[model samples]
Target: MEAALSRLEARVLVYVMEHVPAAVGGRAVEIALDPDGPPAVFASAPLAPSPGAAVVFTLGRSGRRVVATLTDADPVIVGALLARVERAAPAGDPVRILPLAEPALVDAGRAGVALLPPSAGRWFPDLPDAIRFDAALVQVSMAVFLSPQELADAQAHGPAALLGAFGRGERDLIRFGARPR
Candidate 1:
């Protein structure tokens, strides 16, 4: 079965497909909806090696959260990018490790939590649209917004605003101590 992803999540997938800093072993924009462990970071060269660090993110009714993380990571890249984020944390803030229950979860073209696999089409959370956005997008949206038509508009608009959000989100990953390359 395919993963169940929200419309915005789908758009973000496409956005990552387009804007990943680099692609080595494929543009790794690995995302976990509700992850665990040290945040991971993934991007391409000059910024990092191909597939920097897989990114883990999540959305919830209370709020949104994101972190860049890695299973095994590069020291130089980790030092350069994650240092800033780590500094922001209180000493001993544990790295949240997303449980990828299945290795297949991040396999080439997957999305969502470890328990669920990737699926086709837009996905709505198990909630009403009134306050339906996941935590990450909720934070990104910064305000209440959207409808089916608006979602289509956002999707069809070619990820521009989302890209801007992605940029900011990447910075957030750095802040969250996403381990590097």
Candidate 2:
């Protein structure tokens, strides 16, 4: 029998597919995150300009679907990283960097994530509540892998500050194991 998606699952899939560029050849891939963990489907697509870089976002609604844009597009490496996020998602702030025990894909092991609010010319969060999804559209967070020192900097100053450093340096935020400095 064919499996059907729940309402929330459908919404999460639509949201990610709509926001992620189609030019990257993004497509959903189903994978078992763990033997006992919940099932997950993640969208994977290559990022242009940066060779080997790719973006992957979950289609699951557990603790809100997560998006990871990394330098290594390998599913194994990305799955390992996502597994870490899945384990940590329910514990604290939904948007922040979490430390990874080992190097993820690239040289960096630290990972940072932030919610991506809806925007159309203007940020939807600034609009009236009725203008948006009643309970907020399927929430999604962008995850970026970072160096240990970079994670420390984000924890010290703030995620925004670390992101600013990337912007100022013209660094590719999706680059896995990237150290903005």
Candidate 3:
């Protein structure tokens, strides 16, 4: 696979590995950076087992980038990380680092995001509410790249749902694989 991650990206990956479970895969980490006020947004994809494969989604001020990593043949560790990744993402709209792994179906047409099964649905749901929920708390394995808007979004979602959606997105990416540019 190609090496697209920077030093910061790699650090974030390591953090996730250390904290999250192995089953989780396709982890996405989003960060928001703002000079004043709360962050704009923070989000991540779901996590799933990739065994030797891992897809990292990095969000920055400019836009979004993705890096794919293939670890040594160790499915168990991969699975563990995947789980932890799911637990670590943030939710709601706030200035913070939101790690989203699995990406529900992205409707370019509509600014909507949702969490669906592996390949059950075509369109995923958008962020439902803008309130942070305690029950929706998830752990943040690590963070590499972030932007202002992303941080604000995290504050909005809180933490619980952020992690959950991240885990789901990670799994979906692994299953669907990356698309050609």
Candidate 4:
């Protein structure tokens, strides 16, 4: 809640949205799935589905599912972002929380940062060796909204670009089992 975010957190959220909307994506929409209804469909558009920003839609589940995309989505940032989103969020759209680094990583593909899915390998390898892994990587998807889109765009370039641009690393923790069953 805005009441919880520190001044800096609020400033950063506003600044990023105003300057670079990607930090929060253009829009954060929640989808209401109907079991017998047509499959939920998102635009098959570019990452920046909108003219100048990205759009992210999460499945509106029951529990308060916390999806932190950045290491900085720490308490302050989380409180601030949630407060801001609560403005438009409906009752069923689970309040995505900002969990600690480890849990965030573990929840990465499970709709943590994305409604689609993430490869399990992305989180498996070095995570068990938490210290070294955390020291090397800085998760920003949750913190800066556009960071995830940027990471996705980086694939066309190379891993070096991602590391250089974000000052972080995301090597495969292991080589297998990154998909859901």
- The regions of model 4 sitting more than 4 angstroms off are 22-101, 107-181
Minimum summed lDDT over a 10-residue window in model 1 is located at 113-122
Q: For model 2, where is the 10-residue window of minimal lDDT? A: 120-129
Better of 2 and 3 by lDDT: 2
Every candidate's lDDT: 0.28, 0.51, 0.31, 0.27
> Candidate 3 regions off by >4 Å?
23-111, 114-181
Q: Which tens-of-lDDT digit does each residue in 1-181 have in candidate 1? A: 1234456545443443333332333332222223454333323222334243432222221222222232223433332232223223212212211222222333312222111111110121121222223543422111111223333444457334433543354312122223345
Q: RMSD in angstroms, candidate 1?
A: 16.9
How does candidate 3 score on lDDT?
0.31
Q: Tell me the RMSD of model 4 versus the true structure.
A: 15.8
lDDT of 2 by residue, 1-118 (tens): 1225566656655655555533456666555656897665566666544565665655544555454444454755675566456556732354566666655443444445433222
lDDT for model 1, on a 0 to 1 scale?
Answer: 0.28
